[model samples]
Target: MQQNLDYQHLKAQIKNWALEIGFQQAGISDVNLNEAGKHLNNWLQKQYHGDMEYMARHGEKRYIPKQLIPDTLSIISVRLDYMPAHLTPYESLTIQSNKAAISRYALGRDYHKVIRSKLKKLAQKITEEIGDFGHRVFTDSAPVMEKAIAEKAGLGWIGKHSNLLNSKAGSYFFLGEIYTDLPLEPDQKQGFHCGSCTQCIQDCPTDAIVAPFQVDARRCISYLTIENKGPIPVEFRQAIGNRIYGCDDCQVVCPWNKFTHTTHELDFQPRNDLDDIQLLELFNWTENEFLNKTQGSPIRRIGYEAWQRNLAVGIGNIKTNEKTKQKIIATLKAKLDESSDLVKEHINWALNQFQ
Candidate 1:
């Protein structure tokens, strides 16, 4: 059965099915990530990955597709635009400091679940046409160098901020992968188009992008708020502003974002008015309320304590009236006594900002 298959034609059919099933673009790539592996080693040696030990823990499995899944000859990479049609812009949210500025990706459902489900469907479609093929699907789930794979697959180029950038879709999307034993022809890789843009580097609130392609995760607000699980370093707290979940400063300022396509995925739309709500309103959520509201959303993974800690920092950064400041202080004081040590520390820091 495999001997008679037209692998190149099959690749084209797979991409078409991916588009019909909701992916914005799909491409294939040979499994040679040696260059990416070298870069990863250098970044890991400098401890740029911060507390993300899993990044380095995977050994060569991340860069070597065959080691992760033997007999994998090609990788199918797909992009799904996630930006909803309407939301308060990040620029406006920054000035309206009372409102939370979550990374737009998290305003809707978790991309991991959304993309994984679609990838599985894509794999199933391939099996129906080509018979049972060896394949595995992933979206940030394991040791996978998805960005490098996507770039190699010609979906986009890895921009200065280290996020994959498409000339037409910008960086406002998610990537998923399907590794298979089929000998699909690889697409031509895209050339880097960010010739002289320094906007993303200069505008980063915490200067996370230390260099053009290097991001120090320790100084990244997305990492501080979502991954750190401790008190955000005092130095970066004020700069964090009202971003309670993940940050989007780099993507927000990218010149290429002007061409970004808004998503039609209803699951990517904002929920609970999170896209345009006040920090105090989010800060006021009880543990149960936080859990209930963020159910199936990416924000829920950080848990309620970190949620409070992030909101307290956001409230402290609020540029509002004296009456509002007093109310914010009173609110922090109310939670300080009963909160966990981590939350109390951030609440205390918030009260100090008022003082």
Candidate 2:
């Protein structure tokens, strides 16, 4: 019982310290995640996870906190607002027609690095106060179900868009966790506030949301462009618009996002006028240029062939005019002879788009 008291005290101090470290809010929850496990299993059984085989690989280890981290008794979930204030998604979506739209989260330094650093610091601080701890920190690494844990920790409910929705902070934040042996008193779980609003479901361009609180990742733009390795399915091609990276349409249409606090992180701001660059310009980038420009950026992982493939789709979606059409067609044709079949197939499709 005395050890429990120590854990509770440490929990209080940690929450306060988390805010000092630039997190907007922090809360603790017990290790149990049975309810979330069931939902995830059902989603997977339906094959809604698509090409993300990692989701099914972990099995029950993902929900049972102690299984992932032995000696864990509670999870300390933290949220860092990343919206970067007043830079409304609505404005960005409308600012340019031919621009390739990337998700807001990818706009900064990768959250995996940023949030992991803060989580590790928080765990270290706990050791200084409580002598020692058995813990592991995570930032979107592994098979952790962050939205489920965040809801249990009183952070927010996962919204209809499948993003965690906080009434005060909205869903524009990144979540990180620290699994610890501390028996901290858990925070009361947050309630769903999405109510009757169907804005996100109605607004998805690809209709990826099959129903409230559910998303078919196969149709999700983010997964299609970033996760899928080969050709993008032809059915959804035109609906993809000019988005060559990740997509942000669901968040853009959410009314609650109006309250989202913009991020102050410099790493997330637009680079090389990326926020408004034309699709042809990105498609024209040499492989070496792609390497140098996207060195530390999230867009780098898709590799040169996939990068050109996605860009070709964007170019195909653009309005075809004499000069613009010739330039786009010429760009595709120039590299077709040497490019991979994936890039060549997209180039062929793009040429067909021209008059």
Candidate 3:
């Protein structure tokens, strides 16, 4: 009974320390993700994951925390808001065909590094208090069901858009987890509050949200622009619009996001004017320029080739004057000799858009 009381006190302390360490919210959850496992199997069975085979590689280990880390009894889930303040509004950028609409969360340094570093510090603090303990920290780097775990941890509900939605903070945040052997008392999960809203479904440019609480990654612009490596299908090119990195239409359309607080983290501030840059300017970048610009940013993970491919798609969808059209066409033609077959194909498609 004394040990139980100790754990309860530790849980409260953990939450307090999490806020001090820059996390907006933190909650504990016992590791029983059976329902989430079922949902994963169903989503994978439908092949909605596209070429992200890593999603299917982990099998049951993703949902079974103890199986992944033996003796794990509780998980500490933390939320950090990532929306940078005072940038060009997302809706305004999306409508400007010449401007690239990079997702709000990825405008700055890689969030995986930021959140992972903070989580390790939280774990270190725990160690300082209770001595050494078995614990593992995870950001989006692993195959963890982050949204599901966050929902179960009482951070928020998994909304119809498949992003965690908090009534107070909205969905523009990152989630990190610390799986531990500590027997902390779990917080109560939040109730689902999406109700009859289908705004996210209607707003998706590619109809990626096939149904409430389900998204087909093959049709998701974020997956197409970031995760996909090959030539983009001709069908979805126009709908992709000017989003050169990832899509944010669903989150932007969600009513809850109106309550979102801009992040104070300077690391999340826009770099290279990514939040509102021109497609033509990005398309003209040489490989070295791409590397130099995207260094230390999450956009770098997709590499230069995919970056060009996405920019080509965005440029193709631009509505411009004859002079601008010729300039874009000349740029596309100049890269033809250097581009790989995949990029060449996209460039050709982009050039054809002017005709």
Candidate 4:
């Protein structure tokens, strides 16, 4: 009876069930990722990954899906749109130096939880249909090459910025995977649609995109603020501007994002008025307050020190009235004695901006 089961029909059903379980799109692909592995190896060899040592840690398992999860014949890739509708324009926030400019993706609930829960549900639905098939769900939680797998699965193509792009959905989404032993029919891979548009590369505040499809994480604002635990590089501080958490300059300037869809997922919506808060307001948050406000949110992972360190840089970059400048200086000075060395270093640099 099991041998006679129709895997192709089951694949179609899995796509439908994924949408019903809150994923925007689902596609299947075989476990082959030789090309992606090569690209990854080249990127790692060039040391473009910065302090993200984990990107080079897993040997071949990071690209070879079956090696990571044995017997994984096929990979089911899914994307969920996370851009909230009617939010403050990212451009406006960048110019309003007094205001905090956070990456839109981190404005709401932690996506790791949201996408992981949805992936588990989709897997459970498949289990009910297939009777306990071997599968494991992942949402940015493993050494999975999610973007590469998604591209091969026909969900999208890897854009010049190294992010997956879809003509219909742009790049405002999160990716998840289901590694299963089911021999499902793989979908056709999507063609590269970026054309001659170099907006993402040209508009990167830190020039992180060194060339077409190549991003040096060491110079990337997102990496500096979020991934780099110590003080941000002095050269990039002014370029960092008011982006307190993560930078969206590349995505904001992408031509494809004109077709970006607003997510309907409530979990992706902004919480704690983060969408339009001031830099000073966030800078004033006590450690307990920061933890309380960011509970279950992605920003919590950065912890208070890095959070304050980023905000101090943002506050220092403010182009404001003399009165406002004095207030900012006072606020920055007040924290120096109490701050950790990391935060103290940033605060002092921010103060130097005034001199």
Candidate 5:
């Protein structure tokens, strides 16, 4: 029997186990994310997260895993690739400039479910080896500074785009965490390699990046489309370009993406040809079609009315042409007959684009 528990040795074994369990990388870190806590506090004070009031409610518990989970000695951070291949995210966004550009991450099955399932399996494996440990698995659950913990665990430094960047894997991965009492040796923190690049700041179509490392979620297309429940204000709608659900402009222009590898995870691939689907075609999806097509996908969470509203904005943004203009008007009129008042308002606004 192994007499001394080699924390370092256990860490290495866990890393190997995580890789075998579909994680791109695994890292261990002691429970401290104070720097990120300050950032979160400052961001909350400035209301940068918009209507996400939960960001402010957790206080220090959000950063201190031990405070939330007693005796949390270590955090196990894991990354999984999510960029699906052969979908051509940039080309579709550029060519069909009026089409809705859902963030590449949400094109597939709900990542929360996928990552949670993997994390559950990882936790079970640890229980098998170490015999019933104090642990909680998290994939974007409340009060967890996942990115901060991951960065501290040496997964990658936070990029200017405010996403984790792996030197070998790029920034196109989802992060999940396991909080455990196991005293695994910490990994050396990854140093920031961003240098002097500001491409992500410059490439933001809606100018959401107000400063270096500061994102105003209010102006962010992703937040406006997915989180805020109301008419998208006129001021930023034109700047929103073709993006509907979430904007990937920052990531698209990042130099690091050149080294990006395609994900083999089938759940991440575009479903129902979401890749190149036209704005008019998507706008024409019946409520039933919308429900069925987006079932089990992240887009389903936005529901039908918001889906149509986003599509209406996309339709309005399209280049004015005879057939395209006619189609937009025709779609708007169809909605008028059966749409709820909120959807009708968006439909009328889109119809006005052709006039």
Candidate 6:
């Protein structure tokens, strides 16, 4: 009974320590996700995950926390806002056909590394207090139902766009989790407050949000530009506009994002002017230049081939005069003999857009 009391006290301390460690908020939740499991199975059955096979690979292990880490009793979920201060607005970048609209999240360093390191520190702090405890930390790196877990932890309710929405903090934040054996008191789940708003669904460039809470990944520009390795689908190419990296139209249009706070972490600040670079300039990057520029950025994972492929799509969507179009055509023609067949195909498609 004394041990139980100590754990209850420890839970309160964990939340305080989390805030001290730079997390915006933290909450605890018990390890039961039966309803989330059912929803996962249904989404997988509908093939909404697109080519991300890993989402299906975890089976029931994802929802059953004990299966992933035996003897786990609760989870501590933390939120960190990642929106950078003093950057080009998302709407302005989208309208500039020549400018590359990289997602706000990727404009800075890779979040997987940043969030994972912070979660590790939080775990170590817990160890310092309790002697030792079984815990596994995750950012977006694992097969974790992060949003579902975070929502259950009372960080926020899942908004209509499917991102976690805190009434006070908004949706422009990152989530990390610490799965542990501690029997912490679970937080009360926050009620949904989306009301009748449909801004996110209406503003999606590709109409990826097929329903109020359903997003089809195949139609999502973020998935197409980032996760997909093949050529961007011809059908969606025109709709993609100049978004060379991930898309943020849904979040940008979310009314709640008006209350979003700028991140104090310097690590999330934009690198290499990614927040406002032109498509032609990014397209002009040689393979070596691509590697060097994206070294620590999440954009590096897409590789040089996909980088050029996405740029080709972005450039093709550019609205320019015949003289400038000719200049663009000349630049693309120079890479014809050197580009890989897949990239060449996209380039060829891009060249056709001029005609």
Stronger candidate by TM-score (3 vs 5): 3
Candidate 4 structure quality by residue, lDDT tens digits, 262-293: 99999989999999999999999999999999
Clashes of each: 0, 4, 0, 0, 0, 0
Give me the overall lDDT of model 5: 0.85
lDDT of 1 by residue, 90-161 (tens): 778978888889889999998899999999999999988978989999998989999999999999999999
Q: Per-residue lDDT tens digits of candidate 6, residues 39-116? A: 889888999999999999999889998988998899999999999999999899999999999999998888889889
**lDDT of residue 86 for candidate 2:** 43
Give the candidates in order of lDDT, highest first: 4, 1, 3, 6, 5, 2
Candidate 1 lDDT at 267 equals 92
Alpha carbon lDDT of each predicted model:
0.92, 0.83, 0.92, 0.93, 0.85, 0.91
Q: Which residue runs does candidate 3 get wrong by more than 4 Å?
A: 1-5
For model 3, what is the error of residue 184's alpha carbon versus the real structure, in angstroms, after optimal superposition? 0.5
lDDT of 5 at 86: 83
Name the candidate, 1 or 6, with the larger lDDT value.
1
Per-residue alpha-carbon lDDT of model 2 for 1-355, expressed as tens digits? 1253566667789999999888999998888899999999999999999988989999989988777888988889999987654443434653455677777777656778888888988887787776677788988888788889999999998898989988887888999999887778899988888899998899787899999878999998889999999899988888887888878888877888877887777777766666657777888789999888887777888899888988888878886558767777788788888889999998888778775
Two-way TM-score contest, 3 vs 4, winner: 4
Which ten-residue region of model 4 has the weakest summed lDDT? Answer: 1-10
* Clash pairs (backbone) in predicted model 1: none
- Higher-ranked by TM-score: 1 or 6: 1
Tens-digit lDDT string for candidate 5 (165-228): 8888788899999999888888899999889999999988888888888899988888989987
Candidate 3 clashing pairs?
Answer: none
TM-score of each: 0.99, 0.95, 0.98, 0.99, 0.96, 0.98
Error of 5 at 93 (Å): 2.0
* Candidate number that wins on lDDT, 2 or 3: 3
Query: Which stretch of 10 consecutive residues in model 1 shows the poorest summed lDDT?
Result: 1-10
